[model samples]
Target: MNWFKPPVKSLLKLDLQHFGGSTLFELKQNMATLGQQLQKYEGELSQKAIDPSATLEDIKALQKSKEDIKARFDVIKEQHDVLEAEQKASFEDKSNIQNIADPKAKIVTAKAELIRATIRNQAVPKDVMAVLGDRNSTGGEKLLPTTMSEELLMEPLVKNPLRDISTYTNLRNLEIPKISFTLDDDDFIADTETAKELKVTGDVVKFTRNKFKVFAPVSETVLRGSNVNLVQSVDRALESGLAAKEKKVAFTKTPKTGEEHMSFYQTGETAIKTVNGADIYEAIVNALADLHEDYRENAKIVMNYADYTKVVKFLNNGNSTYFAAPPESVWGKTVKFVDAATDPIVGDFAYSHFNYDLDVLYERDKNVRTGIEDFVLTAYVDHQIKLKSAFRIAKVIPAV
Candidate 1:
């Protein structure tokens, strides 16, 4: 049920874009104001009934006025109810934990087991062990809660710049077909029957996902006694570090042994550009122009937050007090300022890809001297930017 499902004129009054998912707030404020108007009309009507000079026409007018406010209040209340339901439904949609049996029971047991990984759930904990028994012959009882899975797996797709743009695949270990650096030189037409297939044999680049590990250290007492929300709270924050590392390597790492692709920020990594222009603004434009037309349309200029500030500062130079700037885009191309990488890169991200089905492994290390146990999570991730010439690397020398 949409809040804007009213008559044409009434719906026109609704500023959906201006408010941007603030329909509920508008409905709430409208209802409150309408309710107040109705109360005012009721008070006026009562006073008119007590006064002898008050005519029937005046009393009738107040009745009509009160009725109008009441009708508006009903409409606003209906809109509020619809929007509230939508919000609740969205939260309900992210339940990957439901894939497991007795999800609620498992979450409860999981929290307890995380506090003390060494102990088993005596009353019979669930199948997180069975799920991983294949990987580890003897598996542990700790299962990540449904809420935690959403934070680590689902949230990063929307929140992390590198993760968002990279193609998400489930294949943990696979060969990516290499991007051909040079075009087939022979332009001579071959007879259709005798045309031989493009003859290169070693055509694929291999990418094996590597395991990333992070730990949250807590005292034995806090683990066993503290609340679920408080103890080992940094478990969720680990995703950011994992995500940052992936992005930096994808966009900057020189190809290691058996790796064929190059990241954008490396010199002559596919295409490299130096600004021949006099000023910083022209340098940015030159970087944008350096990318091939085939890639530039979809390309994003990835830079540091500090570098992006230069664009904003340039836009606001004339306005000392009231200033406005474009929303992180230039020349119709999106500009991404991310925490993961510092050097500027412009490229069509379709050429970049990463595997996504994060399988989180649990481990623990206990220090007898400190009475502290560290809960370590391990996950495997892979990334590559396959296409050459689709990316351009640039370094801007700031004005003196």
Candidate 2:
């Protein structure tokens, strides 16, 4: 009693002009939506063809609809691919400009451009001008140029070893609570009313505060000389001094004077597992097994640079080295090389924590007269380290 009308669907119409303004990501998303709609229409056509009641006219109409949808989808897909290629090329050009490596070269180029813009009395890009700005812009006194500061910060230096393996906390001073459980008796429990009481023990680990300092003296001639790079010199002195001292304290044991500081090796020696006959890989496996299964996920290996190079030279039966090269990983775990680390240290670094009060501070003493007209540079920082548990240290052995 009811007349069946063929379902009517609106065809998708995309504006070719809109592609110029749209980003590559947006164009891709639009193309995906169009493809899905085309699929849905094709599915409907297939369903109608299989229906016994569908007439020859209905089948022909569905086929025409699918062909039209396919044509439109193809055109849009081609446009999206072209736009994506263009976007990638543009991104690479911008990346090249930002990734300029030489600090002096970048500074010279930026300064030259600023001079040109000033002489012509023309407007320069805010980002380019920002590189020359002295103030932080948020507030407070103005400091060095932002670009110079960034260049100084980017100087390569040794990083803290404990930071790679330990649970990091921002707090400088805090009490870390540790708990342990041990089985004293081997008796199995029966279905009776009597139950053996479990023993639980806890201890508090405290990390006291400590301070480290770096000092350097710069001559007045160097500061005044047009050819001398004061920023680079200052940056090198501060970074090198801090890196050397920090590496020494992190690995080597020092007697506790008025201030107590223990190295990672000294704190977790109980977990040490010796490597027999230069089998470093086997020793690392044993060290990992020493850790609780849950803690093993956070485990990492720390070794001296010389020992790391030696391990990399190890060959398998086929003569291929165990490690492909320096700076490569081992067994999917990160292997960090510390030039100052005397022994190989394998542990779940999350158990060791280092806290700092403030980052390195640079102070210039121009008023202090040291007989000569020299600018005294002093750097100061406060930091402390603590080990939460002994199990964190998986192994510590002298490099073979």
Candidate 3:
């Protein structure tokens, strides 16, 4: 479809007199929507054919074209909005028609214009002028300037009566691409520690008497046995009234308690990979040797380690090429690979961006003729992986 040439009248005509308040709102919305649609369709239509093997100069040219179209669309939409609002206001306020002729109206209008002039001179143009215009006053001057017309002075501040209509149209007239893909999740792991203490006690009795014992008492006889098993065995033996009572008892367990020691930790390795490439995927792994190194990293930073095993093969069978992947466990790394290339060309061609604002010559045109191709492999830990992220590539290559 030719987007630049929209059938404006056929698409935009409406019966303003019959449209109720609600319909007027809908019309306003449609105009706003039309503004956006004009820009979008123009952008899509303006896109240039991009060659996959194009050089930096070529890419820049294409970008410049796209940006230029974007700017044009923006300006065109603004103009459309202005025209639409002016049309609606004329329909809604029949009272404004007489203000152009009445002397009293002219006086009020001139006074309002004076204030607007003062404000523009004083660096405050909006507040008082807006209020004066609301009263259908010419915006605050006793005598309006030749440059100041009611319509001209108020054009910027007018509200779009077709707002609702423009909004509906915008909603109904959007253009964008859709994508679908699979997502995956994994697990998290770490190391940790704990403590215990022990206590032991033993008791025995010694013979005691006053400073000078009046008489000597008979010595108490004691029996010896395996007292380790019995808690009260020693006490029982000394306090026993009978002469000798020895019993064998055995304790197989230790008599003390214990507590385990506290545990401490040292920092461990967390390897992350930042992947980027064309047909072939290249992972730039930064071992995150220290906090200092980690802070210096960018979008390539991954939180945890990954194996990053990659397999490369052509979508269709063709000549194979080899390039070295970055060494495993490299910190602060970089990798580059030339993926798909165009068939050999005969002469140096002028290459430019999709916008075609600037062009460059590709010096090594012959070296990459045979359509070199590859893909990248990126393996990241569960925590390191970000879900539902989008990747976009804008490549432009010129034909021979």
Candidate 4:
């Protein structure tokens, strides 16, 4: 018996209107899924054609299924195109702006134009040139809006604890001169210039272009209601996504190429993989004491909540009031709570420096080949180990 098919319009019309806010995000997903269905069905028809035992009816059934899915896919694709046009219209809608000449609004408008141009492969709005600044200055790169860039820097503090404690800089292709190691003090007169060969070794920390890209798939429906707010929403979403990624990059040691970030600027030598002690508390105290005298004063123990809880549970086991836990500092050093840490980081985090430029490069002019295209949020970032001896991993090894 042949399976009967219903009209595609009646079945799929309500789906677009009611699909989880019907944002371009969902529409694209819906279309991609249907596209795969059509492809798989076509493959089935090919297999059946070569099968001697397969009836013509078998091929017809598969072909009908493929056509049904394609028809539905076309509807959503059309909706996606209509929504993109509407978003472009919003970018062109000057009447919505109370003052077209307002500086902030103009910047917002220019950025919207750029985003729309990226989506549709259209010419960037002529007026955007004024706000875009000199593309030649940073080697064909444009800066992100100042406020938005600052927000990216600040968001890490709110979401990433390690980001808060480490030092920060903004200079591209930057070479920061820092003291890598110290020389012993000479027994000479305080005011006299002695010939003690200025032996403090130094090194340069060079900044490399670090690209942090976030793939934002605008919801088809969300863009439908867009005005100037479209840019704001997209930029904010990028900001949030970048900050979250930064958080991961900060804690992960030696992350892969794209995910490269500051992992406390410590080397294997500085990271304390083992501790000499009889108990958990004693081991931590010994580790802190083992840190170089130069760093001991400013050093703090950075432990994520999980590690901190383990320490508290072990130390407070004796819960004897006479020798209670300090409750704030660990052995006179401050305890900083950081997330995404497997083991506590012990160090003068100030010695771990991260440098990134404010000039952002967006890779536009590329077609949106898939349902979503990645927006590259790029900056030249580098990390410096002012003094390797300043950091140590707080890996606990209680007496067994």
Candidate 3 local lDDT, residue 353: 5
Q: Give the TM-score of candidate 4.
A: 0.58
Provide the lDDT at 71 for model 2.
65
Worst 10 residues of 3 by lDDT: 191-200
**lDDT of residue 339 for candidate 2:** 70
Q: Compared with the true structure, what per-residue lDDT tens digits does model 4 show for residues 1-400?
A: 4443446576555433444247767788988888887787788778889999889767777777777777777767866654554444445557543235445555556666666665555655445655644343443445554444655654455445557677776665667655444357544323111122122333455556666666555544445444344664576667666656655666777677643435553344333234455544666677677776666778877777766666677666677532334446446777767677666667788877777665755554333575554445665555555555566665656456
Badly placed stretches (over 4 Å) of model 2 are: 1-205, 225-228, 255-260, 267-278, 316-318, 323-329, 358-400
> Could you give me the TM-score of model 1 versus the true structure?
0.56
* Clash count of each predicted structure: 0, 5, 57, 7
Return the TM-score for candidate 3, rounded to 2 decimals.
0.18
Clashing pairs in 1: none
lDDT of 3 by residue, 314-342 (tens): 32235333212232223332221111111
Q: Candidate 1's residue-wise lDDT over 166-215, tens digit each?
A: 56564546677644354465534232211121232234555665666766
Better of 2 and 4 by TM-score: 4
Scored by lDDT, model 3 comes in at: 0.24
Estimate candidate 1's alpha-carbon lDDT, on a 0 to 1 scale. Answer: 0.54
Is 2 or 3 the stronger prediction by lDDT?
A: 2
Decreasing TM-score order of the candidates: 4, 1, 2, 3
Question: What's each prediction's TM-score?
Answer: 0.56, 0.46, 0.18, 0.58
Per-residue lDDT of candidate 2, residues 113-229 (tens digit): 433333233444444446455444543332334454444333344355544455544343566643233245534323111121111222345655556555545565544432223
The positional error of residue 356 in candidate 3, measured at the CA in angstroms, is 41
Return the lDDT, model 3, position 357.
10
TM-score of candidate 2 against the unseen true structure: 0.46
